[model samples]
Target: MIRNTRSGWGSISRWFHWILAAAIIGMIGFGWWVNHVPARPDRFFYRSIHADIGYLVLLLMVLRLVWRAANPTPALPADSARWTRVAAGISHAALYLITILVAVLGWAHSGAHAPDYSSFFGWFHVPQFTTPDREAARAYEDRHILFAYVLLALIAVHVIAAAWHHYIRRDRVASRMVASDAGTSR
Candidate 1:
């Protein structure tokens, strides 16, 4: 089914979930690698790839938001603690917020660097919000890194929480979002 019910998320939502998960993980890795590479040619190549993927991720995030608004999320497990439920809701919201913030800040950080550093895979140019300024770029870059770390921490918590539900609680909380072909119980 394309639409979610109270029991589990639909295939569309699952696709969005998994794709965004993979993209975010990849972007994080690329972010780390691009910063560490010393060779200008290698770094430029990595940065170009990273920029394109980041743009795709931003688009996917937007589509995911629209998809979420149009679909229903699974209900919380009946036996789940109230605090756990509250934390899950807050963390999920924070994940969405942080993802958007990081993308925007990264875009600005790239744009604020000298000579208009950002482009959509080098096929076209992306406009900058700020003029070239080293200090401003540094600030944006710092915040982007900080937000990326926050995103990573949240992801770790999210994974742990899902594992807790799957193993300790023996619940379908995590299964609801996984592929149906994976034998996820409804």
Candidate 2:
């Protein structure tokens, strides 16, 4: 049987996916919440936590990519209209691009001058990955923020598509991506 994604997307992929979602959502909320706080020395604390989590997301994304390369998924539902398939492909591709873009910007922004903290989310120390400089940090920060907005919009579309498939299409379009028995009994 042809598999678009390895049966159930492989253990690593599932783990990476859930973990990445947690990290991204957590960082987004924390980052937004902290914006109202004063810029005291301790203000860096929240950011430190956000940075660490963001780094882990990057590493996991890389591993996920490697796994994707190793196991190519099957096409979307064959019964899906051609336009649906195209839209799905475009949305997924955009998700991937945004993932990379956000991770890189986040790393570069923090790497310039890491505060007195370590670990990509308190896990382990990540040595300053880039030279210390203000210009570099600013540029990286701008890109990171811009990409985050883009990512949020894309995620909105992704959720809508999944909802459409599950509630309206009444097909396995969404399940196939998340379930091992997706196309079974075909």
Candidate 3:
């Protein structure tokens, strides 16, 4: 099953979900590291790596959004309360929006800092969207860090919700993402 069904996620969706989740979480930690490390000659090297990952995340997020829009999303359990469904919807939307916003903010920051900051792993240069300006770069970086914390909080809630479904409700909601499509319908 390469595409999602009404009741469960397909392989592609699951892959995207897990891969993006890991990449986003890793990027957040890496960004923190880059900021906290002592200033050294190689500090830009670390920032470059972080910028590369941010570009990749932005690309993957766009692809994931397209895939999600084109596929069927698994429904919440019928027994779920209205509030649960609403919260899930809002959180999911926020996750997608904030992830994209963070990536864009990082890109803007890099663009404002220097043309070299937008290099995509040294393979090619991403066009700068903003002219080089130290103050603008600083502002962008601040907002980027703030939104990242918000993203982290949302991820925590997402994990807790999934755990609630799997452990407390003992339902298939969580397994719908992890389970094989052995007996599921397309």
Candidate 4:
């Protein structure tokens, strides 16, 4: 009833978004940085870190979905064209689903052997989902990379859409999702 227009994003979405952003960005950076190191141990360390970030991203994605389901999103911009809204809806869904699948596939690639069901710390163990096979690892690992490319494409589309709405359209489409509810423009 008392929605403030310019306050802040909803707590659940805000936390979900920022944390997932940090993890994915960090994973991307670490992935780029990994090749520079030659030592096997160092490589493993980088891999482990990247994988950890992936796990965090996947976990957050699940939580975000649940939150979205329970709370529902604010309405789309009143003036947004039907096709534009549909494209945005589809692209956003693809981003969430593909990103989670990519991470899960990668984790399965690495952890199928149980690998001690490891985490970065002794913090906790994520159960190994299946048994190991070198061939299976290679296949799923390649698929995971392909999934990454697809995710990147989807992200590009999302970014372009956000920019189009914010700049060209002078709309609050992206702002409502990213902003704390400064006011209930939605």
lDDT of all the models against the reference? 0.83, 0.72, 0.89, 0.71
TM-score of each: 0.91, 0.82, 0.95, 0.85
Tens digits of per-residue lDDT for model 3, 5-65: 8788889889999999999999999999999999999999999999999998999999999
- Candidate 2 or 1, higher lDDT: 1
Could you arrange the candidates by lDDT from highest to lowest? 3, 1, 2, 4
Q: Which residues of candidate 1, in runs, are more than 4 Å off? A: 181-186
Model 2: weakest 10-residue lDDT segment is 1-10
The residue pairs that clash in candidate 3, if any, are none
RMSD of each: 2.0, 3.1, 2.0, 3.2
Stretches of candidate 3 off by over 4 Å are 182-186
lDDT of 4 by residue, 1-186 (tens): 222232335766776777876777666567657745776756676677677777778888998888777664666667778998788788878888898888888888877533522575457767777577777777777787788778777877878887987788876766766666532453
How many clashes (backbone N, Cα, C below 3 Å) per candidate? 0, 7, 0, 18
Write the residue-wise lDDT of candidate 2 on 24-126 in tens digits.
7677667667666877887787788777777778888888777777776556655778998789889878987898889777877887653433455555777
- Single out the weakest 10-residue window by summed lDDT for candidate 3: 177-186
On TM-score, the leading prediction is 3
Q: Which stretches of candidate 4 lie over 4 Å from their true place?
A: 1-9, 35-39, 113-117
Compute the lDDT for candidate 1.
0.83
